[model samples]
Target: MSLTPLNNIGEFALLERLAKLINIYNKDKVIKGIGDDAAVIKPDIDLVQVVTTDMLVENIHFDLSWMPLKHLGYKSIVVNVSDVVAMNAIPAHVTVTLAISNRFTLEAIDELYEGIRLACENYKIDIIGGDMVSSNQGLIISITAMGYINKENLVYRNGAKPNDLICVTGDLGTAYAGLLILQREKKTFMANPYYQPDLQNYEYVIEKQIKPEPRIDIINKLRELNILPTAMIDISDGLSSELHHICRQSNTGCRIYEDHIPIDMMVSNIADEFYISPITMALHGGEDYELLFTIPLNQYDLIKNIDDISVIGHITDANEGMYLINNIGEAIELKAQGWDSFKKEE
Candidate 1:
């Protein structure tokens, strides 16, 4: 099959094709979308707006060797949506921007947009507007997500109080385990081009890494249950790093149980294969995108029956310091050793 180069159609034609792919879900909220100076949005009168932006660069954030453009597009939106949802808000709109080199074909760009459209449809979000630019290097994706929430429901990182319960949604460290499997397969393929990777057994972790869903449902569920989170953050960096952010901002300390840190069976198995500790991955492996939050201790009964939510620990006074209680009941100081964007690559 002959591939159509992006230069063949030019920028305007490309935009026209992309605009056709998008379907605005919140027609009442979006006054204007694509093909305008800027997107016009109708704001909620009583709710506060929540906005977040995230950029994914090729090689730095993803490896195209195994990462499909479609999945990359979906994930770019999800990472930003996760941020908005972390604030106890439902994401409503997003603007996607892309910088691409000459090497990428028009068809490749279409595949990426297809993934974006799917995510918007699933989340009931509108693609308001965005920019496409030429890049000297590989592909770069930047997405800004917007949402609104009632002032009473807005959760921040600095609202935790002593004795509040520390909770997290879904499992942790699975994405990092998926990354490890992908990296291993990539290495094996690089060393021997003829070697075909057998990845049937690693589906769970692989999917978690390639296509992680934001914990939007959890936010909605909490609202239905009338459970307000005192402090909240998405576990994009890692469990330990996000916990530190909450503790530092709230001027409180934390004590999490090692066993309570949820880890998937597949993640533990993969960690064993890699000769790494599963608990270490749960604490420091990034890209989980799950919600970490705190609620009053009195609300424990409301969450105890929830299967996906785990009460891993509790907040404490600042003077007590942050710690993790091991299985043997020994306390270890918590440290943030998760993803650092500016950290020099070894």
Candidate 2:
């Protein structure tokens, strides 16, 4: 017998290996199983069901010193809800499970639930049920969100066609900027216990990191405008990485412009302060939780007036190749240089 490190093979590879071991019994009921953002189930003829789960662990996914328990609770739910929204589905219910150590108090657990309650209220979802268990390690939270969409309205990552307009909701890279600031502050505080972190200036980015809202509003707006996305995925990873998912799934290529990638001024300033490239951050920063979707070229005029959505690029023929045209007019092949949790850093 031999032992191998999971990090050496990486997350996607690990997933692929694990997926090969499973047997899908009910093929008709399981519309989608292991690949997409969520698992699609055909519970009925007219309606399609979506189930998505996200798990957050202490230190690996978050730091308790910087990440408040309340925010963690809220974020766990939001991230799962974002997956449902990525499928163009409305989240109706969620089940949350928590693993806590002796260090976590009853009051602390209540605080976490309060945040979950607030998110449920804001998102108009019900907390159906979940589990609570003891953990020898640190805090861990997992949320599974279930939602439904009409069979006709359901969108997947593989639906984009040539010439479809690529769109994204809100801005990108703010969460990574916030994480940098928090880590910097944490290091400072570790060196000096009396020092108080001046986080007022980095409020927006910090909030973006700690408390992210799912793109339910964008889903609602798209529905109201009668614009169904041809292909879509939530930017849980990075813009470039998610774009790769869409392009690979749809069997199409994309041409996004550097100038058109939307970024907030606050994020830009913070990146500048950190001596990092804003565009690079936008492309490779993870945990943005924004929706990346494509629409038919003709439908562009309808969504152009929508303030938050940005038309950054358009889908192209697979033979044309995926690219990012720089400001100086150079076509650079896009790469998925985003965060990989399982990767072992060289």
TM-scores, each model vs. reference: 0.98, 0.86
Q: Report lDDT (Cα) of residue 343, candidate 1.
A: 45
Number of the top candidate by TM-score? 1
lDDT, candidate 1, 140-216, per-residue tens:
99999999999898999999999999999999999999999999999999999999998899998899999999999
- Tens digits of per-residue lDDT, candidate 2, 1-346, equal 3444433444355344434433444444556665665556555577878989988888888889998888987898899999999999988777677777766655566567767777877887665545666788788888898888898899999999999999999999989899899999999999999999999999999999999999999999999999999999999779999999999999999999999999999999988998998999999888889999999999988999998999999999998999999999999999998776554132
TM-score of 2: 0.86
Off by over 4 Å in 2: 1-45, 343-346
What lDDT score belongs to each candidate, Candidate 1 first?
0.92, 0.84
| Model 1 alpha-carbon miss at residue 56, Å | 0.5
